[model samples]
Target: MLAVIQSSIREYPLKPQHLLPLALATVLIGCAPSPDEELNATLPQLSLKELLPQAVANEYCNPKLDSDLLYGIGYQLYNDDKPEQARSCLIMAAPTHDRALCYLASIAEQDSSKDSAERDRQAFGYMAYSAVKNDSCAEFGMFQNFTYGMRGQTPDIDLGLRWLERSARHGDADAQQTLVRLHSNKGNLPLAYSWAKVLDDQAQIDALKQRMNPQQLSEGEQGFEQLSKIVTSKDAVRKEAREENIAVYSANIHMEYPETFKGLSVAERHALMEQAVATVSARPEFSTRGQFYAYVIIAQQAQLKQTGVDVLQNPQIVELLSDTELEVSEAVKKADVILGQAAL
Candidate 1:
């Protein structure tokens, strides 16, 4: 599931001196508006669902459709700011679709009506349901609820800490980031370094390095090696791809080529290019957007060589390659290294 909470709702003052302050000073000047308030301001005057026909809604809730397809449709609808329609599709997918459940919980949490207590209860129930299925975001939500106390529940720090660790291990970025600070504040630099390394936060790694002596740094490195085996950035990459609509684009790729793309129409060729773009963008190995496009160019060239169909001839492909923002040569070299590793 996409990480629902960007900024934490409640800041746990575990070790105040060791806590990292907000980088932007202006954000601290006054009472900042809640995340819900910020979200409400940006929402469209009319929902996308309001414009669509009733048949579309019925189709989304169709029992004949695959759960994955239903969830994907719901995911797109939710991101497109049509929560009411999204909720219907999500409900159809239900308990089997854990990420859909998370999205539902997020939608419920945004309710500001007088019966919001009931909404909170429903939201908490959704998170609890998904958490047991090992959904990282749900696990993180459970950690937040248990640690801070919500929906008339009492705070239990010990239980919350356990959930936090579980969430981090499951590759929830927020939980890992929280652990980095918590461990650092508690003077466990090795554990802190392990998580920071997992996140590939160069600044945090560098800062942590400066604070450690040779022995501590060595131990941190050893800890990182061990931690990395269990936690990967792929989960983070997948979440990012979903939020950016890259997953939807990738899903459009037709892997089974009955005929060469060269024989296809202009629209089909454009779609082929989009598929190639999506493939590269969804990969975790590419470090930057420039690198992603560069790799796509390389991959497309390979495809042309193998199938004798020049997808790169498509206008969309040509336009993307023409952009000066891409660092082609260097990124291609790095991508080659990743390719070589996979080949081994």
Candidate 2:
């Protein structure tokens, strides 16, 4: 054991001063072990839930460990599917509210049962509302609003647009594109033009100009052609599935933020993206065709950026179409064929 000795350095000569050092020495020797070593030695005896709070208390009040540790613990709980526990861990870490809100939204979306869905929806709504207050990337808030009917508690296009616009203002490219699509479908040419202008590609802008009225576009025929190509394109399916999975998983991962990976640097972002793709790729529920659709959506987004229209006609888009585009179309064809066979 490490120990210290309390001896008087000054010559005493029977003086009263010598007694002062002697008295204090006895008291100092009694309590010498550092608090941390003692805690670490005893920690194994406690339950994980108990130990988690203890770790949080140490990290929060002791000022020894980095704050990122808080997020790490919260992420562990989240991945374990213990959202309530994860929430507490994150709260103690005091991570961003937006991350917490995203977690709440994910939990709601994952539940299929009606009663559970309602409870999850309410919980998600409260957090998403809080999240949207801080960041527009929290447009996941609009998704929640659309799905659950909060505020006035009825689905309203006006309210949806208000939220989407709020997200768009925050520089979300997705929201900007979504607005263009919605306006185009509604035959609001002026609104579509306004939103489409925000895109980086000039070609896409011109294509938006060529957009026929909703009535003129054959939903079934055009959609069928697109679907047929998706299934046949291997590269397209891989990219699409990977991206879609990443988006969904990233959204789920976002739910655990601040407490799970709050200060994540760019390197960490790429690692998590890779992990999310792997997780989605392994899921049997996500068929190859489904994966193809996911890629088609991505290719379409790329096309829309480069050409300004959802329907791609550019040479580059055409080249990508035969490659990724064909994969997506094939996937769609397979789905249609499967459905037809099932009906028979």
TM value for model 2? 0.37
Report per-prediction Cα RMSD to one decimal.
Answer: 13.8, 27.5
How well is each residue in 1-344 modelled by candidate 1, as lDDT tens digits? 45444353345545422222221122234346622233223222332233212324553446555454466677767788878777777776664566666787877777676387877776776776677666778778777777778644478765566677667767777888888877887777877887799878999999999999988888788767766655646766575445434433322222112123335554655565557566555645445555554645556544644555443444444444445565666545554454445346
Q: Of the candidates shown, which would achieve the greatest TM-score relative to the real structure?
A: 1
Model 1 whole-model lDDT (C-alpha atoms): 0.60
Tens-digit lDDT track of model 2 for 61-157: 2233233344445555667787656555554443333343445445445545547557544444544444334344445355335434642245554
Candidate 2 C-alpha error for residue 203, in Å:
5.3
Off by over 4 Å in 1: 1-61, 112-114, 232-247, 250-310, 314-317, 320-344
- Per-residue lDDT, model 1, residue 224, is 71
Q: Cα deviation in Å at residue 174, candidate 2?
A: 2.4
